[model samples]
Target chain A: MALEGELAAMMAAAQRGDAAAYRALLKACLPVVAGIARAQGVRGEAVDDVVQDTLMTVHAARASYDPARPFLPWLGAITRRRAIDRLRRAGRRPVEVHDPLAFEAEADPGPAPGAHLETRERGAALARAVAALPEGQRQAVEHLGLRELSLEETAALTGRTKGALKVNLHRAIKALRASLTREGE
Target chain B: MAARHEQLVEDLAGRLAPVRPLPRPGLRAAAWLGAALLLGAVLAMRFAAVGMEGQAPADFQLAMVGALLTAIAAAYAAFVTSVPGRPVGWALLPLPPAALWLGASGLGCLRAWVSPIPDLHGEHEAVGCLGFLVCVSIPLSLLIVAMLRRACPLRPNLTAALAGLAVAAAAATLLAPFHPHDTALVDIFTHAVVVAGVIGVNVLAGGRLLTRG
Candidate 1:
């Protein structure tokens, strides 16, 4: 409560032309915002971006501050929004509740490089096999496997349900594996 | 990191132009009440009072008072919310007044229901009453929004919504006296729509727009 009260007072002073207090508040808020973003499951490059965006948002929305309210709820709301926006931008919006039941079926990638000519032939064979699939399967492979979009984002872009996208992706992977195995044999 | 801090500090200095704490709620409440009264007087001069044109409802004055109180309380709440870190509960300041105003509108609707008057749907005078309310609210809202923007509300939409609600309700107060044609329910429904519109617009976009602070 003291920290909360302290931040609120600093925020008020910062509102009142106290530049030093403003800087202190921003600095103090950085780690907190970053932690919040991380807790939302943001990782690596996206983490810093979300934190930066939250900071910028906080700076911009300072006028709407209410002295009667706890400061964290306001900050928390902004932080969560910036994190979601980041996730949305990355095309990684999670579709399901993220249980263990989900399967991420990647397109059969070419085997690890052996002889250079063999690698080239196998890569070409894999590409041809992918191209031969139905358009829906091909699109699913490209979006979910090649571009690494989540099921939700792929569904959104393709105007299909998550279930449909998952089915298409799974089928594409199965077809690719069979085609590659037959060619190898 | 140090460089970022320095830059942020510099930005804060640049942004800190004129820091004005919101006026006390009582002061803001009184100011809106006075402004409503003054505007009502002027409107009365231009167009005769509703009583002059027809036998005004018995609760017209009471409804006007309720609207004024709504204006006052909401204006105070808006001001309080604009200052970041204030308790969220302070936004509740307008609830009682808003309820009072709504209750008064209910009575007016009840009266309209029993009497020969059109209930809510047929009140064509609503158009003019709404117009008058907007006319009064626009300036009041601008002033409050200006105040809110200076404070740099953390929740820009919430602050803007309250500011809009306050001024619009303030305008409704003045319109209540001059508007004899609007049934109570019409005032409530129309005013609610306008206020919600204000809130929605601010939430969607105004929050981004009001960040000058």
Candidate 2:
């Protein structure tokens, strides 16, 4: 209820052309939009660009928004589309890497009680590895590993054929695994 | 130097602001003019046809026409809102006229449905329903086309066309009255499906054209 009231107030302010309200709304929503874009494998300088573009689209189209509806779905749709647009512009190729650690992360259910520390440590290690990847490679990993784009979609967006994207993605995964394993040891 | 974090946040916020102003010159005028022309044509055709029939003027016809035109305008306003870079000003502009249309139509339909007048013939009723479907479908399809044109980067036309078909099918299902007659059922299905297919084809072709480099 509080969230709804805040959103309604924010929307009302936005309608009144309140720049502060618009800025507040954008700032509050930024992390979620950024996460969605990152999950779609967008990386580096392009991440900010995609987010900005999505925000612009959202702002320009604000009047069309029905205050009666939930905001997340609309935001998600814009983020997803913008991410796809960035991928298309970049023409990055996909890579196919069989990283046991990454696959394990997906396959494992919730961490066991005693394993919580280990899980946290591993997650931290993975985050550092992701942060450390070469800009291009990091993007490929994020797109394939996090966003779960099909090889075809990844290729189409990046202008790389399936084989090329696979190669790049493999290299990215190998690097991430090596970094994590080193941290583990 | 201590305010660096705040500065960064402010900078990011500024960059993310919507850079494009609402487009004002030609496009807005075109949209409004187009809407006006459409409403005028619909009204003219209805009145002209009714006069030619040389039968007792059914009060219901005016209501039906009024309701349809209002719905069309409302739907169009919705489209304008949905379009990227469109001003908020356009949003409210279309509503008053639409509300008037809806009010007139609603009253007419209600009166007709409740009146002690003899039941309309099966054929006439079917024709009326079909007319309603077409009136609703065409504008809605156009609205979808307009939206797609704005949203799709690769092939606006094709996207618009496909979007139009989808909109038509969905609108028909929700808005058209269901009847038991085989002919009515067939007509409904046929109209819905055909509109969908036509719009899809138009969008695909438009996309190809737009993207051809």
Candidate 3:
């Protein structure tokens, strides 16, 4: 005798392009997926991200499931992979140090008008100047400087090697200084 | 932008398109039956050319049938177990047929169970036997995997292992007629080693390929 069941049948219908069935199946599997993720040591925002990623992975991999078979092992496999991926990604990223003065305004106000104008001009010039650098440098500035992201974030988001990101940032800053100096004249 | 769960499900469902399932087990069996017949014909032709003729013994005949049966059952097991949460015991479907095959080997198989110390410097022909078994198993395993590709397999290693076993069993059966100086000990030993090696390799490497997320 074979075990006949709901999850497999639901998934089968979902794969048939039945929107309602797909939603219902996804809803049903969420708890099990979440539980699996939590059991694997994923916590907080990362847990939800892992779960979402698992859902997306499953959606992408849905066609590989057989309706005739029981469904847990297939779901478990995908869930396990996503969770592992998240863990690795989190593990490899550098922690961002806290800045005590981040929210606290400068203790003393700087010299006004002329400096601000020079700074404003420099800011405008830097924005325009950044565009002139090579694409890699430009991207590094965009993520690390303009976006105020940490090196780890930039590396993770852009999928660039950390060393490459550092080089690009350094080069971009050097290029900007040269461009700004020319503008100063 | 909002809840990741609803957003993902909504996104996937919005873009979802599903294809027709592969033909049922009966059709698959029929197709394999054709493959078996073709292989039998090829073997027959080779036998004729070699001026070799002999009736397949009663037990070997049963062994051949068992191999084919194991292949089919294990293939189905691989497909079924691809579904998430399926009982792992489904992977055991190959057992009865496997039992029949070894039983057909008679006491000679049991007597030959004394394996020599394993060696890296094995005879060239023994290495050739491994290659031959793998060559036969690959196509059969690929077909099994392709059939199950429509189903999401949760246990990639287990699913792949079963498929490997099935394909290896079928390959082992095919090797019998061409093998020189066949003995039950050699037959059982060779097939077991071949099947185990193939399954081990597949179970190790096939996990990601079968259950890629």
Candidate 4:
């Protein structure tokens, strides 16, 4: 494609330390990198983080590029790698679940008027949401989120490795957040 | 977010300086191979002076050829894999030659088993051979890893492992020309252990060096 050729030319020039060409190339790469993150299932503000991380990686690795080869695949690989890294970091962190698995009792009554009804409706919606998840995701949410089991315990109970459980938990959280956001809207 | 992205682009462009791209993977690999061969030749000469006097068996010759090929293939693979977006499958290029080396060496062991002869060398000589392998591998591994660091490898551990394999194969091949003992159980075991240690160290340390933070 003409666009790929143009980008490759820009990159070749950028490799020679042409500042304007480098700037143009990076600015052009932003949308492509962001789109790649979305295609790889990175969503929301995290896509922006992936785009930034990928640009940095591209800068660091520019010397490795072969001008004789097409540039898009090289860029795509770096973007995907950065996107996976973001997903892995996100997976490793604790995810919040909507259901009330723990309680910290306050001396004062919680809320007034229809607040209890609203809370009950939200909890019911969350329960339905969890039920609708695929088996692995649902189990991950239950063992890792609702029950608050350690990763080791969850793996032991579910017969999944810790890595698999983490991936499932990450996917479940993403699905729930999307579903809940749509419902809220 | 847009402002931050713009600022980042500007900063990166501003910091940019004239850069020389790395040579093609094959060319870089050849350079590494040249250095290895030169060192191997020197070591072979030195080893011949004090080593046992006997014609090497056909199996030993086959093992040496396999080791040489392994060194070339693995060195090329390491360079290829060091570049971002290259096929990771390049990492497996050395496997065939590596298998041949192992198999040929194993045959030597089997042959010895069938025709129980006196041991080729005493325990101290075996230990000396081990020391030779480890010492020779150190500089070779360092040199290859240094070359690899020029390119940013997404899979640093894999690239480093390949470099370790290349260096170990080259050093082991060098030992063949003047090895004081015939290939047997102890020699095979020693080489295997040394090779594994070299690869392990590279994966742990060289991987860190290749990572661009």
| Predicted structure with the largest TM-score when compared to the true one | 4
lDDT (tens digit, per residue) of candidate 4 on A36-136 = 99999999999999988998988888888888889998898888888988999998886654324533343346578899899999999999999999999
lDDT digits (tens) for residues A1-185 of candidate 2 = 56556765675566556667766776666777788999999988778877777766675556544455556665676677788888987775543245566666775576667797877887787878998987667767777888998877777777767776777778989988787778768
Residue-pair clash count for candidate 1:
23
Compose the digit string of candidate 1's lDDT tens values, residues B1-213.
546645755675567653454555456557655766687688789877653456666566666677777777777777666654456687888788777777777777787667755333445667876677667766665566655565545556776777766766777766765665546565668877876765565455556766532
Q: What is the lDDT of residue B45 in candidate 4?
A: 70
Candidate 3, residues B88-203, lDDT tens digits: the string is 78778888987887676653344335543233333554555566677677666666666555566666778888877767777876666554323444445666787787788777
Query: At residue B138, what lDDT does model 2 achieve?
Result: 62
- For A1-185, candidate 3 gives per-residue lDDT tens digits of 12227777878998788888888788778888888999999988888887888888788777656677677767876787789888999988865434455535545476875887888887788878987889999999999988999999999998999999999999999988888888889
lDDT of predicted model 2: 0.55
Better candidate by DockQ, 1 or 3: 3
Worst 10 residues of 1 chain A by lDDT: A99-108
Among these predictions, the greatest DockQ belongs to 4
> For model 4, how does the per-residue alpha-carbon lDDT over B1-213 read when each residue is reduced to its tens digit?
999899999999999986787899999999998988788788767665455467767887788889989999999999999887788899989999999998998988888788867875678878988889988999998999899998888888999999999989988887775575477788899999999999999999999998875
Fnat of the models, one by one? 0.28, 0.01, 0.56, 0.66
- State residue A143's C-alpha deviation in candidate 1, in Å: 50
